[model samples]
Target chain A: QQQVKQSPQSLIVQKGGISIINCAYENTAFDYFPWYQQFPGKGPALLIAIRPDVSEKKEGRFTISFNKSAKQFSLHIMDSQPGDSATYFCAASRTFGNEKLTFGTGTRLTIIP
Target chain B: DTAVSQTPKYLVTQMGNDKSIKCEQNLGHDTMYWYKQDSKKFLKIMFSYNNKELIINETVPNRFSPKSPDKAHLNLHINSLELGDSAVYFCASSRGLAGVRQETQYFGPGTRLLVL
Candidate 1:
């Protein structure tokens, strides 16, 4: 299965709070998982990525927790700010094959002050 | 400087008309790709090219064609465009074709095409 299912089609969080989004994949062949952030009228940009070997990755205030056995991954934003509001998408891909990233349905996150 | 650039950011056309969207990457990447984002916000990969060689071609219609003149450029051409063809087309590129260990792809601003 090439599909990557993402939950909470939309999320609302208050400033200084934490916002989390989860995703799951059926394709075990996927070795690379990445999250993308897209602002209105712009292209999706890579936010954070993780490999199966690592269970967690933290970059600044953004963290990605990955589960190998469960085939799940999540994105956590600490101290959520209004600027962080955007559409987040989870994607998966195998490096050796076609190297095409299978994207999720995307989650629209709103950070309210 | 812009890493990936696309021409005709917005295209509005009538049915049966043909159109082409051009993409170029200044990142000197070896691989490039074309994606279509439908109204539902689903980003689907249409084609990918590595070093001017076609690598991946999704289950797109025959009316759509992708041409890569060189490693820096990949253009998409559509024939007999239909109403369903209206969507945002994005062009992206990576340093290499290997994804497991490749750098994040650089994406263009995207070209929105409206077919009437």
Candidate 2:
């Protein structure tokens, strides 16, 4: 079973539209949640990360809405642009000592200009 | 640039062949990791090295071995590659220090391996 499950296998949005991707995790041990952006033939880059302590964390136009009670977290891109086109992955890590992260399946987001 | 880098961005070999992928990080991080991303894009951690010590070793096959020559380098060697071994391998690094819990890893471009 996948520890972290991400929704919307793929998403399409017009430029300046709001794009949202949701992820649910089964493990409550997960304390650290992070989102990664990956382009074709490139490594996934760290876009934004958050701890469950905060209900929400926003960086630039990317925001992470964390629901501790529901064990869910979502990434919201405000005013999505064509440059935001990439595969986004949500990951969870338990202890700080263990860097082994449980990554979600992945969500492909395409922004049309 | 100051980042984690891996060699042979692309590797194509036949089954039963032995190959190795080298990784180096100039970020001066104390910990390094090897991750395998399959065709389905499911990324899994295979191994991790802290400083010069072998730390996390996932339930992987014995044929796959990770060698850390020094603190700055970690190489992955595969003996008798199988079709199942075809995937994109990524090398990542992160800081390891006391009182510092969270560290975002920097990943290399990735090495695509195709086993025929």
Candidate 3:
């Protein structure tokens, strides 16, 4: 299946708190996993991504944890702020030649001020 | 300038009408894709084009067709549109068509279709 399942359809966190979103995939052929952040009335933008070769990737305040055997990955946002409030989607793509992505349902994260 | 751009950000039409949404990507990427997000917030791939050629066409209705005039543009044309066709459609692109999943995809702001 092309589906990348995500958990916690919505999330609420306080400012300075940690925000976490989880995703799982069914297609083992998928080689690339990416996370997207989208604000209201905006398109989804790349937040963070990881490959099966590496177990984790950290970019500034955002980090992605990947587990190839589990076929799962997660995005962790540290020091979450109100500006970080938005929808986050986890996606997977075969990418070896076909760079098409299969997106998750999306998680609406609201960081309370 | 926007990396990926689309026309008619919002479209409202009556049932049985025909509509088309045009998308253009300026990122000079080699691959382009179309995704549909429903009211439930579920985003699914509809079609994909590479170098003005069809690469992927999901199990979408025959009423829906995609046309690629060039490497920078992909347009979706729906004939005899139905109420069920209402959703937000997004266009996206990536740099390389064949890689080990290294390049990141750039997404366009999305076209919301409201079929009345």
How do the residues A25-49 of candidate 3 rate in per-residue lDDT, one tens digit apiece? 9998898888999888778999888
Poorly placed runs, candidate 1 (over 4 Å): B98-100
| Top DockQ prediction, candidate number | 3
lDDT by residue (tens digit), candidate 1, B8-103: 899999999999999999998999999999998888899999999999899999899999999999999999999999999999998865443656
Error of 1 at B50 (Å): 0.3
Angstrom error of the Cα, residue A11, model 2: value is: 0.8
Q: Which parts of model 2 have CA positions greater than 4 angstroms off? A: B97-100
Lowest summed lDDT across 10 adjacent residues in model 1 chain B is found at B96-105
**Best model number under TM-score:** 1
Candidate 2 residue lDDT tens string, B10-116:
99999999999999999889888899999988888899888878888999999999999988999999999999999999998888543357588889999999999
How well does candidate 2 reproduce the true complex, by DockQ? 0.58
Write down the lDDT that model 1 would get: 0.92
DockQ scores of all models, one per candidate: 0.60, 0.58, 0.66
| iRMSD, all candidates | 2.3, 2.2, 2.0
| Models ranked on lDDT | 1, 2, 3
CA RMSD of each candidate after superposition: 1.2, 1.5, 1.3
The residue pairs in collision within model 3 are: none
